[model samples]
Target: MPFPPKANGLFYNSLPPESIYNATPTALEQPFTPKMTVCEERQSLRKRYQFPEEPVDRYVAALSEMAPNCAFGPLENEMVRDQPIEGISSEGIRERLLSIPDFTLEKPLTASQQMEIAKKDAALFSIPDLTAAVQSTESTSFSSFRGTGDLLRPTPPCFRCGRASHLASCSNCHAKHARCRKRDKLGHFAQVCGSVKPSSQHEVVHSVSAVCFTDIRRYHIKTQC
Candidate 1:
């Protein structure tokens, strides 16, 4: 398989390393880290990257306990005044979010339910079911059909075996298999109930019939008819 496209990080990381081991520190080398007042740094950082909504009372209280000399800008003062952070509780939001169902997880379905879904999909795709079609219609004769509007059509020979009458339908030739005496795939007899010898020249015709039946079944499957 071809490699997938990688982001810029891959190219940057693929370069050869320059320095290996650390050398003795020179006079120009920087000190480990100069002593710095965190109070001043925090003040400057707060001024530069301040939240638009701040709880003024709580911040003032916190600052009074630490550093009171820090000056806040007008925007910071306004933000602190307009928003009240005293009553904000993350726990409430968490509880509310937990109440909803997560649809991403797989749902359990029984075998029968899955089968029903498959039948529905097959109907949508025009898959044929000969036995069902035959049984569903009120007609006593085989030629008289029913349920012809949509989502159903005539089944190939294979599907007829699946009907309640046949029990799981023949896979070889939809309804036209050797088992089907009406179609006569074996020439002398239907593959389903044929009594003729398999060595006869008619066997070729039967084989071809079987193949045609299978092809027809496949075609019917394509349309879900």
Candidate 2:
């Protein structure tokens, strides 16, 4: 006896009988309705959609590809209009989108309009403000030049007595020197003083004389009174 006719496999027993095959078309055999297909496509596009870091035109193009047949209803249309404003990586571009004069909730901007504004805003953001840069550079250069000039400038001599390194009030000549006879002022020697009034009738003069006697017998003297 051949082992009591081998038992049917568990998988074979679990499968439906042959009658179920002709009961009705399986889900795979049923042709999907257009609405069902569109719904599935929308769900898939939503899941796969990503806001790229590319230019606004490319971003708009990507959105267009999401619903090529324009099958999205009013709500989805609103989403398509507003997504870039919310999802844009550039704060500047987002602000530009938000600031569109005619882009109210009731009257949303079209893709072409959004693309145009975004392109303009991106261009403006990319350009450097040469006037501001020039002003900043000039300010920095002036500050640096002023600092160096202060460092390199020569220290003036003391005005009172022609001394170096200190102002007249702070110099050693301030107290140590006698009053100038010419100016009748303190803190300076008469010979080295400045800013004194000149006399019209007679001028002050200083003289020095030296005499040496080598041979007394051959010497002659002269005098003026």
Candidate 3:
């Protein structure tokens, strides 16, 4: 049946284009306020404490990531006051809070006791080991590039060509056209030089030649006759 004509012709029902619930007994009988789930409660809380889209305070962003972790920090007692969010009961929050690790400078025995006893003996509970830890508490070591002896320093780039090479120069640089020392000119090297005399120094030949054929012209005339 429609609403009274005097009131309106419009069907003022909800989602999916219908008032299917109007005739159903189950809908009318059910509780209007349903109990929220744990996730729903958490989401409600997140919306309530939503980080401003463009937050001016840097702490806001940091706090969002570490919100659950805040339970273990000093800030838990000061800045973050717990509010009653449904499904996050006092007992639940306390259990979560207890599980979070609190960093304190107390004796290491408490943490050691929580670990498997076999492993604890190696690092924490033994008097000797504990003493060693205490002694080395102030010791510090730094990470760095390995010592100069440990690494072979890369060779500086060749000046002739701006590239790295091992044997004083690169192959490209070595193959370049070098001036011929023999001819004092470029394009061809000294080994292939066309110079009439070799550029290298030579000893002066001082020994006299003993040639016995001084009548070469007379011998030629007798032969012709």
* Model 2, span 33-107: residue lDDT tens: 334477676665555433554655566556656765447765665656666676556565567677777564333
Q: What TM-score would candidate 3 get against the native?
A: 0.14
Clashing pairs in 3: none
lDDT of 1 by residue, 1-225 (tens): 643467445533444464322322321243455644766744543443213343323434443333323344444443332222222223332233234354111111122234445556766757467656744552333122112211232232222332323322234434433345576343222433333333433455466667655655565454444
Per-candidate count of clashing residue pairs (backbone under 3 Å): 18, 0, 0
lDDT scores of the candidates, listed in order = 0.38, 0.53, 0.37
lDDT of 1 at 191: 36
Q: Lowest-scoring 10 consecutive residues by lDDT in candidate 3?
A: 201-210
The C-alpha local distance difference test score for the whole of candidate 3 amounts to: 0.37
Best by TM-score: 2
What residue runs in model 1 are displaced by over 4 Å at the alpha carbon?
1-201
Writing each residue's lDDT as its tens digit, candidate 3 over 1-225 gives: 866965443333322344566544444444465866656644543444423232212323333454454344555332322321212223433344345465221212233233324443555556886666654642311111123212333434333323345322345565135776766764445654543222211211111111112233344344345
Candidate 3 steric clashes: 0
Over all chains combined, what TM-score does candidate 1 have? Answer: 0.14
Error of 1 at 69 (Å): 45
